[model samples]
Target: MAQSNPRKSGYSFAPSPSSLGAGLSVPVGRRSVLGGAVGLSAMAALTACGGGGGGSDVKEGTGAISFGSNQSDAVPKAAYKKMIDTFKKDSGSKVSINTVDHNTYQEQINSYLQGEPDDVFSWFAGYRMRFFADQGLAGDVSSVWDNIGDDFSEAFKASATATDGKQYFVPVSYYPWAVFYRKSVFADKGYDIPTTLDEYISLSKEMQKDGLTPIGLGDKDGWPAMGTFDILNMRINGYDFHTSLLAGEESWESDEVKDVFDTWAKQMPYHQKGGLGRDWQEMAQGLLQKKTGMAVFGMSISQQFQGAEGGEALEDLDFFKFPKINDEHGTDSIDAPTDGFMMSAKTENGGTAKDLLEFLGSAEAEQINTEADKSIVGPATNVDTSNYTALQKKAVELVGEAKHTAQFLDRDTRPDFASTVMIPSLQAFIKDPKDINNILKDIEAQKKAIFTA
Candidate 1:
């Protein structure tokens, strides 16, 4: 049985593993295999191609443009406010930002989608965007894309583009997710960050033996667990196979995917025993307090901890890329979800919004994001790394050098499939480790139904 939270948490369900059922199985022969340098070069070229416009089209206007975001921190709020101020000054438009509670932001977005649509808003890439785009709530940004050229990273732009090749959103910032642990704890245990599957398990076992929970998991939010599962899946099947599986072209029952879940089941015991019931914030607190040795989470969690407790405790915390699964496929990388901005189809100020989007891609907005601490990996635009901690800089370097970094499963796939198939499948797996095959079978069946329907 899944553990119950004593905290009376509002987010009770085990986070469904995938946000949208975007994962599909593709034939191995059709997968695109671009090296990291090639990928970056392509993105750079894309941006350069789009860089010729000036800011003359935007000036003060009478239109009041409302923006929305789920960012909860003062840092992000202040930085965003500064950007809004700049937008107002340059465009002569009255910009209003509605900051909502992070937990209820999605619901707010859903509600707003039904009522008065704002001019621009923040959204997750992949699955979430698909739902809005498909529903006609999001505007096609192909014109904006041509203007913003190579200013947007190819991967980031691809994230906002649908399979039909139309772009709907513009990315603001993105960061990599990984296992963050205390450097002192590793030193005390004489364990280095693992680079292979065997070493990973062995390290967890040693940590467990020393009376330390190896992972500070909080499935109460479900997303953190989903993040872990995504990383594991990416490593097991490789990015190409994982993408195909999410796109409905492949089966989850494949040996590679099964191995991924089986490996996760083996490590279940190393997680904090009651992790199934804890919220991510609480789990982060536990890790910061040193009650657990590690937490498989996004860089945002690190920023949250540092903000809540000050930087003193965070000095010992460092992160490592998810370990390589096998010697043959040795890319030390993990899921990277890019938070982006999009224009509403209903917005009256399309020109103003377009100007803001281009401004966001500039070095000025990138600096704002860095100083806001909203981005651990910072923006894709060129920025000085001297202000970031060594660990943060290291994460940026790893992502830049990655052979391929996928968006998280929930972010990459479709929402209905994510909520119905992916998340539930993971919950069922947690309920019964021996039921791994059944879980995959169920997911496979769901994928077929959704894609064929």
Candidate 2:
């Protein structure tokens, strides 16, 4: 099983070995990857990226470049190795590769970027990308965009661009966050897909009557629950509200945000109890065993189904865009985060970094990467969709239909707020649903301090 979480494994980008489905693609709007983690100066002493602990340079050949990768799962790791091998073959450059565990890499990114980041390194597209660009840690890739601009959708270009409007990230793949369910479970139960909040709630009640948990949630790692919160906030409050809220422009103590929690608390009876004790993989197991009806996550959820029975487990898995809560947003928005790569601003091999980024942004690189791993969709507009499975096609359609695309909560907000404040806050909310107002006030206080700093 692929075990990457944007918060857990840095997100699994390979299809579950069990499912025969082709690559998963979710075309989110204004596509970008990343969380706004620490806003430290990008010019800090080059310790992590240049140090032995980080992605240092490779002085092996006349034209050499180093790549730091976080696709740590066995399948995706192998896929990346193949990509690097192919790059070496095609470009005739001595490519040095450094691989790190996914979550570890993200956790250490600040130090990594400030230390000895590779010439090119794997990263996400949005606030995370922008945060780095704004800090001056990421290499300016406007020139690479000059060549590949028209090849991507404007949304993707927007994803690659920083707050200052310079392109710093190069997106290679993406997937959508949706409610995943077992087709067989729904088919045997004869339950229809609900479009509205009332119908969805009613459906949850029906699932409960059928002796199935309505939703499978695990927040032991703290980040999994954010998916649930993201969908609900977007559904109830709308996308713009969500973007502003994450940007720290809106008050966390508002009645609007509280309504999202109150409604969620009402549905708590149907949610898996003991969520704080379970991680997402355990929740996925509940769906696989028919103990639960559905889960809230990205296409990467399929990654949980691996091994000999992967095909059977995956064949039964299907997802729907999260149900609508309000007529205004009305299911027109989704969390479809884009994941890709960036470059160190001070890479000794500057020209080499740009060349590699150009290739990484190419349909050829997208093809190579997607073919090696089936967990995500190739981001290049021209990548071959001939091999797309029914589910992959559905994911693309779901995202393409969306009017607004939110990077997952962690990706959308400041890293400090997300990892430090929100993760524990949500986990605490799951543990004790009664302290809603206090939680909001505390979060707002922290947001004020962090944003001001």
Candidate 3:
């Protein structure tokens, strides 16, 4: 069910009760402040299985390392734990991890700049890491990066590098976003995955005619909608325009972005009913149950879908990349989110952090990632992905050969812009499409505030 509007922002800012469970509701008056708390709880639960011994001496060469992890799903958590355990056995040094809530993990890390600090922790690439580097909380890893092979992929490195040309983090995993659909519905309707915008719209219309919601959407968490919007915008305007907007080089009101909003307005009706208040997991349930014909979501949705309904329900479920928008950005692009690790500048165990970072890049770590199914795209460039599902393998191929792949919006832009500009603008577009100019203006103002303040 939809959560009640917090009555503070005059918007339904709380996550849907069904999404995270009944007890986790968005805070009323202090939405921003309390959002972190939800994240904190989630992170703590994820990292609970991993523990480390107390800090020890450098042992002539080795050093003690402290680590923190953002709330991750069971798979990634298990993979990380295995990696840490192996590190302890190999290096003979202490490695401690302090787990926090996923929602508030970033905030908690930011607040921990005082006395004690984790040596390394998971982080998103792009502006999120840039914020920490700017604040001097992140350590410079240029020297460490110099040792990794060029085969690790330049795109991955660039994602973790700041505009000032400093490497601050190393990405361990990434996965693409696409439309997951019920194959039986498509087979019955004689509809194949649409390759053009017109075909996509026409297909959606036909699905609606057959009494099926063509798209499953959940805006209760906000980020899911933003993810769809980002993909649509990227397809419409291409990577250059998307990058310009993210780098603050282009205004939000540009014709390119306007087209994205216009497309969303035209496609809104095909979305699942009550999507505005549904959470991502709930929306995924709709797809799994076949109540909705399709859902545009992350690769992670596969795990939840299979878990909920078993593999039989997924026998007729499949995924396809968002259809091409005139092939302007190249028809083969994929959207992915990269999660990585960054070392603290104040960490007492720089050597240990470096060891872990290097270890993460090894084939052994990649094997752990694959065994745990933590990511569809593992960090080791040399690993064979023949074991991955057909769709997963396809996504990996697309990402590998693509001319460009941008990180998702929330990670690509500064947090201030993500909160004050991108998310709000997308939400405004949903509430009132005619307010495009106002939304753009508001986002621009927020961008200015970020730079000035």
Q: Please give the CA lDDT of all the candidate structures.
A: 0.67, 0.76, 0.66
Local accuracy of candidate 3 as per-residue lDDT tens digits, 1-453: 110111011123422110111111222222134445777655433433321222222222257777787534454566678888897888777887666545555544444432245788777776667766665557777666787656467767777787668888887767778888877777888888887888889988988888878899877656778778878877888777787788677877678777888888888888876766787777878877767888887766665555445566645557887888846575545567776788777666678788887777666666666666623566557766767666567666666765666777766665556655566667777777788788878887777666443
Ranking by TM-score: 2, 3, 1
Q: Where does candidate 1 have its weakest 10-residue lDDT segment?
A: 1-10
Candidate 2 lDDT, 1-453, residue by residue in tens = 352344335333211111111112321221132324334333233242232211223222236878998888787777778877877888887888898877667767765775667789998877778766775678788888999988887667877888777898898878888999989889999998888878878999999999999999887777778889999999999989998999889999999999999988888888998998887788888988899998887777776764427478877788987888888779988887887889887677767787788888988877776765566777777777778765666777787788777778878877767767887789888988889999999999988887775
Clashes of each: 37, 26, 9
Candidate that scores best on lDDT: 2
Comparing candidate 1 with candidate 3, which one achieves the higher lDDT? 1
Q: Estimate each model's TM-score.
A: 0.77, 0.84, 0.80
After TM-score superposition, what is the CA distance of residue 197 in candidate 3 from its true location, in Å? 1.0
Best by TM-score: 2
Whole-model lDDT, model 3: 0.66
| Model 2, residue 150: C-alpha shift (Å) | 3.2
Please give the RMSD of candidate 3 to the true structure.
8.6
Give per-residue CA lDDT, model 1, range 1-453, as digits (tens): 010111112334323221223323321221233546685445333323211211122223336778876665565667778977887787677778987755455544543553455677877676567656765667677777787756645656667786557887776666778888888778878888887878888888888888888888777555567787878877777777777788778877888888888899988888877766777778888788777888987776664456544666566778888888755556644677766777676666776677776676666666667665633555464666778777678777767766666777765666577666776677677767788988888888878788775
